[model samples]
Target chain A: MIDHLPYGVFRTPGREPRCAARFGDHLIDLYAAESAGAVEAGGTLRARSLNDLMSAGPDVWSSVRRQLLNRPPLDHLVPLSEVELLLPFEVADYVDFYSSEHHAGNVGQIFRPGQPPLLPNWKQLPIGYHGRAGTVVVSGTPVVRPGGLLGAGVVGPSQRLDIEAEIGFVVGIDSTLGRPVPIEEFHRAVFGVVVVNDWSARDIQAFEYQPLGPFLGKSFATSVSAWVTPLEALASAWTPAPPQDPPVVPHLNDDPHHGLDLRLTVTWNGVEVSHPPFASMYWTPAQQLAHMTSNGATLRTGDLFASGTVSGPQRGEVGSFLELTWGGTEPVELGAESRTFLLDGDTVVISATAPGADGGTIRLGEVSGTVLPAVI
Target chain B: MIDHLPYGVFRTPGREPRCAARFGDHLIDLYAAESAGAVEAGGTLRARSLNDLMSAGPDVWSSVRRQLLNRPPLDHLVPLSEVELLLPFEVADYVDFYSSEHHAGNVGQIFRPGQPPLLPNWKQLPIGYHGRAGTVVVSGTPVVRPGGLLGAGVVGPSQRLDIEAEIGFVVGIDSTLGRPVPIEEFHRAVFGVVVVNDWSARDIQAFEYQPLGPFLGKSFATSVSAWVTPLEALASAWTPAPPQDPPVVPHLNDDPHHGLDLRLTVTWNGVEVSHPPFASMYWTPAQQLAHMTSNGATLRTGDLFASGTVSGPQRGEVGSFLELTWGGTEPVELGAESRTFLLDGDTVVISATAPGADGGTIRLGEVSGTVLPAVI
Candidate 1:
């Protein structure tokens, strides 16, 4: 069993947003727990969000985790189903990285056709771009279908809607303006991980994403899990990342066993579709962080960066609908339902689990979102 | 002379950041002004930033402007040179729109070689993407040179540092989630405009920008002018946007005279190099805003969206170094200093002026940034 106390924001009806610690199906109200002397922290756990807690740094994080673990079960422990979960932290900046070589190759082959599978600079850098932070909603929030101009010269609701199953890292500490965080110090910067469902409009993306990149096509809504799995909880999940073929820069180089061996599963309407392995990723979290700050771009508290479309080499390991259905040419069969691309009311659930120290499964929570009809 | 009060954040020596408004050579301290009954607003005028005031909406904005104009000059008025200006508001989201047809054509010709000047979807939608808001600094902030992996296998400081002269719109009111803000309602959403210097790294951009977009290349430091010219202040500057060849969709089509006729100038190392005209932009701000929210992305207060490289048809009207230098083949002559890209200690200044009522020039302020030596 996963012995982790992932932090999240929850609230009962008529009550304001409150911070809580999740353990199984119960939520320990940190505000009430702190008031009862169960956990002593200088920061405001009473705040509606986790931004203040995240900005408290690693020492405070460790202390809070220890305090929560040591405390006895309090009366404040409420069943998870009773409370509504909100976005854990206010997003400052959201960046999505194409970290998996398998995913990149598949996308390149399907989209470009005659072009090289991977770009010439793909092996050297963890390629990433800033994503719309305003559109980042918590898991369980219904995603409305985005309407925009598409490749076929048609302008209306998206025809080829898709979802990318990925893992997200949350930044805790704010970095200095011009300082670049070294790859070895990534753990100090990033506090926790969460599952993310990067919603996309493939047809709109193909048309608009030429020289600049993805815009409204992928900016409609990006769903992230409410429960943030602390970095301390994933100690046993660490594994060796895929070896770099052309080798990366010194700044991006990390230890061999730097990747997380999480098994990410993508389900469409409760039916399992893809199983993208996190260990098969070409670039590690450290490399992504290092690359992000390498440009003198400061990292703010509540900043999030996700591994884009974590796909493996196997046929069932594709992370996105674009990859699994081969750009909507191949249809996926799910019992009575068939799908090439996400239709109206399509629900996508991405769950993840990692290896625990006791050789048991460690649940990293899940992020799921249902699609609403387009407002065309 | 033009009578306008542009808001900004400034500091004097060891003091905290204070809200101020510029008129001629003086910056009126809004905090002190409110205290002295010069301006009355329900919100905190004593705020170190203008975000609170901005979120107050157009009514508060108009009141503040009227009060400042009606009152006589007080002791709170400090010379602009005495106080150091800072970023006016906390940017929630930063979007850069490729609204200039001339700049787009130049870039397409240089980058794609034989391809058409404009892409198929270029005229259909106002192309834009989310940019790194964390790196957005105020005008005077010194930009540290960025270092990242390049295509030539060299991993160090960027070799081709450049700047893009553009106009930026600052959103004040928060729009509802999953709702589209109409083209006609753009003014109600966007409060003011600013001069923007989009600092870029050509080498890094060329290598990394692909299916994702500009990341490290453009995320280093995007500078904005300290003073923000309110939409109400630029009434006379309104002119017709260039007629769309194929015509736009219903949602994008607005009044013919929707574009602001702002004459923008870019100076490199104290020498004027470009004179990009905002009137020559293909898409209007209304269209950009409408297209942005058409995908259901909510607009938050302090959200900034900039016109990407406001270039005209003239030779000297190119906004970016990539165009002015013709991809470094035709170096721009700056008197004794001829250059293709920015060098160490190079200062870039972008200033603009718009036609005011009563046949006067309305100063739109300026955004300037100096490049520091690379930390390789």
Candidate 2:
């Protein structure tokens, strides 16, 4: 897709939803290519989300990516199997984080076996929480299977049912409440990248994650990626992250190329399983937006955040099914049966890619789902 | 004032913010009392926030509270010092909870000193999380003093800055994402009450709350309360709650009159100190909205939640200065100025009240703020 044009919110049969972009499988219609002038952007592409062209910030997002690569609207295409998409922005505060030190040492050695797998402020920073931006959603929706309690006075539904994978970002411009969005203003305060999922419920997050964290075992839904992708289509997907031996705090210092190298994969039910690299993420999406606004926390324009699972230290690189089934006491297999968590119809699907500025690759927008059985 | 009419979002002078209502000191302008036909609500109070009159729910919130107690628009008054208010709704996902068993046994005995101060799922349920809905704000706003990493390779500011006097609620009907909102549908899904604060930091939430919980030690600034109040102005403030020794389960049981009573009053700068009560809350805002939608999480219309630190077992009934300075090893005087946290231009406020089917009280709108220092 000519280095992934991304952006989303579609529609078709009886119009309305607007935005668009994509390209190869066709979609364009950025308000019908700016009403046929073939794209200029001032009228924020007749919005229906993408937070009005991501709050029209990074110089009108690089002048609408150089007028959609110099006018390639082809009379506002459409096809992508007759539209639909949606949820392409309107999250406004989600957070997530846990920046994967091998998925926090495989969820702290499968939930603290002998304690100390990572938590000492996990190499000093990016820990993060706050989710449930009204149960996120859009990316083949479905999901369900939640129900809670699960321990002393146990409740039901959710017999495990996991899947994390993450990545998210989004949050275009808007800051100051007591400012703090620094680390070189993360591409002038981010504006793209998606593929999330995050659904969990591991026994209602192991009996309600102690001391206040994962609520309702991960607020019931999550999913995401109905396109987006933008950070100028991953400018050759940065890279460097994975180092910080003991260095983090100067307001979460940064720039070791500020990682991105994507790669992910996941897929269950269709089998592929895990690949999860994102350049082995050890805290980077500009140090989780400079430690989520260091403490003056105020970002807004459809806020989001994510990047919490994306594992990577080998053995098929884990991005969760409780570290690819180890916490389900190891399961895996799949193609001919054999799983662990997540079952009622199970689908999954994550996806990713990156390295693009022409040397080809670029994908991102995937995030499927499926489950659907609880509502009990 | 005739049972606190509440609802806010003002403006005036050059005008724009819209929606209003208060009354005692004046400010009716609900779209100029729906253009002088003096209130019907179909156009949802000429909007500017209270989320289209809280998604026009609860039977148009009891037919606009019986057409504003039989049309008392008084020609859309206005005075409340010529308007301004703002931030009345548009939050959509905040949460918070930890249903005060004396503020989670005084924050689990000042952060687990010898462990177990209550946390066996804190007597079974109602603990919560998800905050930072774009740093909440709007009750006098200021706040600041945030800064982070306060430990290992330490960062600065926030020596202990705290506060938390709780009780929020809001939401307003919108649920079904795999259902669950049970506990007798908490008045058809809430729709009122405010007065929060919730700002904290305690050395950046004790060196970044161990394993994922309080981010940026309570996402810099959470104020709330430019009014709202109306759960039919707490019809004689409910009462019963505080008993569950160990029952709770069945979708969080519910209805020991479902608490409320209210009271509150913290203050600080003009020193009152603490009162806290809220009928000694022990989980009940209909069991924290049935344990926050018992995992089927959905509810939208500006979703809020809150009710965490409403401590109360004795002495000054704490709602945090980390348990009236117990964590900073006791201080609290204020007039002869002793204190123990939150300094820079200090301020605070909080306020509350309740019991009023007519027999007096009502209130709830307070929530002030101030603090402001660290942008470092």
Pairs in steric clash, model 2: none
**Chain B alone vs. reference chain B, TM-score for every model:** 0.97, 0.36
Residues B18-59 of candidate 2 have per-residue lDDT tens digits of 988788888788887787777888888887788988887999
Give lDDT tens digits, candidate 1, residues A189-209.
999999999999988888888
Best by DockQ: 1
What are the candidates' interface root-mean-square deviations?
Answer: 1.3, 9.5
Two-chain DockQ for each candidate model: 0.73, 0.29
What overall lDDT goes with each candidate model?
Answer: 0.88, 0.83
Model 1 docking category: medium
DockQ computed for model 2 against the true two-chain complex using alpha carbons: 0.29
Candidate 1 C-alpha lDDT tens digits along B151-230: 75688788889899999999998987777788888878888999999999999998888768899999989999999998
| Deviation in Å, model 2, residue B143 alpha carbon | 33
